[model samples]
Target: MPVLHSAIHKIDKKPDGTPAVLFLGGAEQVESQARDDLMHQFNESYNGTAGKGWGFFHAESGAFPLSGWLGKYLAGVGDFLKFSTIAVEHLVRLMEESNLTTGGHALFCHYQQGLTEYLIIALVQETEAVTMTEELSLLTIKRLDLDHIRLAARINLSEWKGNPQSKQYISYIKGKQGRRINEYFRDFIGSQEGIDGPSETRTLLKAFSDFVESEDLPEESAREKTHALVSYSMAQAKLGEPITLDELSGLIDEDRPKSFYDFIKAKDYGLSETLPPDKKTLNKFRRFTGRAEGLSISFEAHLLGDKIKFNPADGTLTMRGLPTQLTEQLKRATA
Candidate 1:
């Protein structure tokens, strides 16, 4: 990772709605091993965090002017330190307006990973810890709480510059459902939700299922394909990368590399070329298949507890609310 520029500022505020104070960093950070390590750790945590939403920046205007300031910095109109100061000032104003008094260290990092450039903005807090000295004396210290990163956003500079019309170039922690806690932070960055992670993942799975059904593959072949999909998706998630449809299709079947991709395109699933996989949905996605003497059964793993139940002691499977088509066929056969 090559860090172009980095800075950390401080926001002092209390939870009792006290006035906020902004302390801006005087200069951009110099390249160092510690800086590199911090960026790496932050990336790992951000990637592993769930409930992140992807979107593009809102229009650069008075209300959401961070992008304009960033544009000036990127265009060589001002130094990074100046730009970060202005940005943090805007954050302070938003925090005050939102009645959000919680404050911490705000980190801004501009770095390059591989051929792509990214800008990461995060608010990190510190936790106290006890450590023993070389003489065995106990000492207390404060360390960054990287494990519990709640307020952060990463902008894909490469994508935003290359594809101005793209809507999913910005990814940020959106907090859990029914909570608008991160709304102000999002407004500070001027981003809106463009893609629903869980919904998109579900759609991708549905498209995969349709492709399998259309191909009429054998049980073993289907199982292999399923494993290939899950493994590739999980690996991408671990690396903090999105699943590329074409690349995944090739991995699924080397002989017919474009088969799946073409199927998805023809069906119009409305999936982007690359999709951020939702780990929770992927974990719940699995196929339970069983075949015995003239008996075959298959269903999704998520349906096990709701529609299907298995008894380990009795070695039996019981299914409720059978499909209407199957029930109608059974009734006709009995009649």
Candidate 2:
């Protein structure tokens, strides 16, 4: 009840656009005072303990010994490892729910920057645990470890002026082997297909990736849903009518192109009068387009203007992007 009451209080708004005061249980004066005191104490205790080894722990004051704070933080790798494990679990769940599999040489990555670094750490740990699976280098290991890498960067930029050991670690990362590792990180993070890629494909991939993360759905469930959609699209393509956005939106189901175009241009609550979609809705459309495009490319399907058309009346989509070779393959698969 306390948690629920707390949530209600956070959500409740007054008519004057201010937060509404919520009394715990009732309007009892003694209970309300106690509750307020308890919340204040809890917040203070949490703040005191939260960033013990981080610079923010003493941010209220004028303390700015970043290296000192960061050094203390580096001593607590075990605590960080536990939290990273939980984060990785959630990230994997998200990937699975998005119908994404981490295979191949790890192409088509769509990880958040933090997760990208965390994965590097996990890989470094795995390499250390095994015996000579490949040639090993200390600089490579450190580069993959964000804390070590950041410490080096800070020291190089003359920001880390703390412990002598921190200086030594940076010196090591700048050594012969370390230079290569540093270059690798720079390329990986900066490339178009990497964590900070600037390509539209990357953006679409990230949008789909985020959708799964936010939904927190299971991989098998997402796979099933996508499989149904692909089958529907393939069937429509085979019938020579294909599926249009209107048909996809339940406007019409007739096996004809004109029917789809007509349904969309019907005017009343149809495509002609539809407003622009919100960002979220637009992203959904983009994701669908990307997925279909990926499938088409894989199947050697045609996707020129001749095959896929867009009607200006309602911005409706009509697609037959699957290639003839893929169509035959799909028929064989179904048979």
Best by lDDT: 1
In model 1, which runs have C-alpha deviations exceeding 4 angstroms?
176-178
Worst 10 residues of 2 by lDDT: 103-112
Could you estimate the TM-score for every candidate?
Answer: 0.95, 0.17
lDDT of 1 by residue, 95-151 (tens): 888777669999999989899899999999888999999999999999888998989
CA lDDT, candidate 1, residue 295: 78
Give per-candidate clash totals. Answer: 0, 1
**What do the candidate models score in CA lDDT, each in turn?**
0.88, 0.28
lDDT of 2 by residue, 1-335 (tens): 02101110111223353423322222112336554443334323322221011111122212223233234434554333233333233333333333322211110101122211101111111122223334564332311121212211101112122322221112111223344443342222221111111132223223333433344445454444344434554343232121344444332223343433443344222221111112222223322322343232111122334567669899665767565976999999999
Listed per candidate, the RMSD to the true structure in angstroms reads 1.7, 26.4
lDDT of 1: 0.88
